[model samples]
Target: MDNVKKRAAELLKSEAVKVVIGYTMGTNGKPRAAFIQNAEDVDSLIFNAQCVQNLAVYLSKAEIKQLGKPAIVAPLNVLRAIIQLASEMQIQENELIVLGVSPDGELIDFQNFSAIEKYLEDFNMEVDAKEKETLEKISSMSLEERWKFWNEELAECFKCYACRAACPMCYCHKCAVEQNKPQWIPVAAHRLGNLEWHIMRAMHLAGRCVNCDACHEACPKGINLNFLTKLMLNDAQEEFGYTGVTLKEGNLLSTFKTNDQENFIQ
Candidate 1:
C-alpha cells in the first residue's frame, strides 16, 4: 500500500501523470474507482483483494482522457484488458502509464506496453478448474438441453445493458442494441430478443474477450453470461488456435485462414 501511494505521489508531483486511477473506500465500505489528481491525495489509493473492479475501463473515457496522460493502478485482468485495447488501437502505449499488480499482491511498475506484455507471458490464461468443470458439464449436455438452459437463463434479462457498461472490451461508440434505423436487434426484452442480444454479445467477444468476467459480475439477474463467452472462446481456440490479449496477430474473426475448416458450411 505504501509503495502504491509513494509511486502515485511521485508521478503526480513530477507531472508525469495528471491523474492516478485507483481504488478507494466507497460509502458502503467497498473499494471503488478513485481518480486522484493531487499528489497529496495519493494516500487514498488502496489495493487489496477487495479491489476487484477493473480500472482499465476508464482509459478510453473522454473525461479521463481530458485529464491528460493518466496513470492506472491495474490488476492482472486490467493489464490484460490494456493489452487487448492496445492491440485494437483503442489506446497508445505512450499515452498512459501502468502500475500493474500481480495476483499475489505484488506491485510491478511497467514502464511500457512491451514490458507489460512480457511480464504477462508468465501469467496463466487458462480457465480455472472450477470454471473448466462447469464448462465441461455444460458441454456434455445435448444441443436441445443446452438451448433450453440458455433460454431459461436469458429469460431473466431485462435489457439493462449493465454487462456492456461494465466490460472494458465493450468500447464501441454505438452499440448494436442502441441502433434504430435498421434495427439490427429487437428492442423489447422478450425471449427471442434477449437470446439475440446475448448471442450477439458472445459472438462479438468470441476471440476478443479476456475472460475478465466483468459482464457476469455486472449482470443484475446473476445470469452466467461469462459461460457464453467462455464457450465461444473455447471454440475459437480449438478452431483457430487463437486466444485473446495478444499483439502478434489480428483478431481471429477479422482475419481469414486458407486452411480453415468448413465442415459445417455444407
Candidate 2:
C-alpha cells in the first residue's frame, strides 16, 4: 500500500495527475472511494479485499474528466471496465493514469493502461465453482421453469435503480427507462416493470458487461442479476465469437460481419 501511496503522491506533486481516485477506510469499518487531489492526502488511500467498488465508473463522469489527466487506482473490475470503456471510445488512452491493484491486494507496476490491459490477459471473467453450479442448476430447467424462476426472482425489485447506478457499463447520459415522452418502461414498481427493467438492462449490456457483479452486490433486493448479463455475455461469445472485454476485439453487438450466423432467425 505504501508503494501506491508514494506513486500517487509523486503523480499529484508533479501534476501528472489532477486527482487520484482510490479507496479509503470508511467510518463503518469498510472501504469507500476517495478522490485524492493533493500530495499530502495520498495517505488516505487504501486497497484491499474490502475495496470492491468499481472506481472506473467515475472515468466517464464529466466532473472527473474536466479535472484533466486523472489517476485511478484500478482493481481487476476497474481494469476490465477501463478496457471495455476504451474499446467503446467512451474514454481515450492518453486521458488518464492507472494504478493497478492485484486481487491479493498488491500494487502492480504498470507503465501505462495498455500494459495494464496486457496484464489482464491472464485473467478470466467466468464465475467461480459455486456460481457455476448455480448457473448449471438454472440451465437444467425447462423454458417455462426458467421463466417461472426468473419471474419469482425479479418480483422483488422496487424500482430503486440501484443496479443501474452500480454498473460501470451503464454510462448513458439518458437511460432508456427515463424516456417519458414514449413512456418506454412502465413507471410502476411491480413484477412486470421490474422484469422489463432487468431484461432491457441485460440486453443493453450484452457485449459490454465485464461480469463485475457490482449490480448484484448493489441490489438491495439481493437479486442474482449477474446471471442475466453473464447469459448475454456467454451468448455473445458463442454466437459472435466475441468475448465482451477482449480489448483487441470490437463489441459483439455493434461490429457487423458477413460471416455472422443467422440460423436463429429460422
By lDDT, the best candidate is: 1
Given candidate 1, what's the lDDT at residue 198? 92
Task: Give the Å shift of residue 107 in candidate 1.
Answer: 2.1
Cα deviation at 39, candidate 2, in Å, is 1.5
Clashing pairs in 1: none
The residue-by-residue lDDT of candidate 2 on 1-266, one tens digit each, is: 88888989999999999999999999878888898899999988888888877888889888878877888898899999998998888887778888887776677877765786788878877555687678789999999999999999988888899888888899999999999998879989987788889899999998899988889888998999999898887777678776447566788777789988876675
Screening candidate 2 with a backbone cut-off below 3 angstroms (N, C-alpha, C), the clashing residue pairs are: none
The deviation in Å at residue 137 for candidate 1 is 1.4
Q: Give one digit per residue, the lDDT tens place, for model 1 in 1-266.
A: 67777888999999999999998988877888999999999988887887767788889888888989998988888999999899899999889888887666567888788788888788866677798899999889999999999899999999999889888889998998899998978999999899999999999987888888878877889999889888877778778877556865878788879999857785
Q: List candidate 1 segments past 4 Å from native.
A: none
Over all chains combined, what TM-score does candidate 1 have? 0.94
User: Where is model 2 more than 4 Å wrong at Cα?
Assistant: none
Most TM-score-accurate candidate: 1
RMSD of each: 1.5, 1.8
Task: Estimate the lDDT of model 2.
Answer: 0.85
Q: What overall lDDT goes with each candidate model? A: 0.86, 0.85
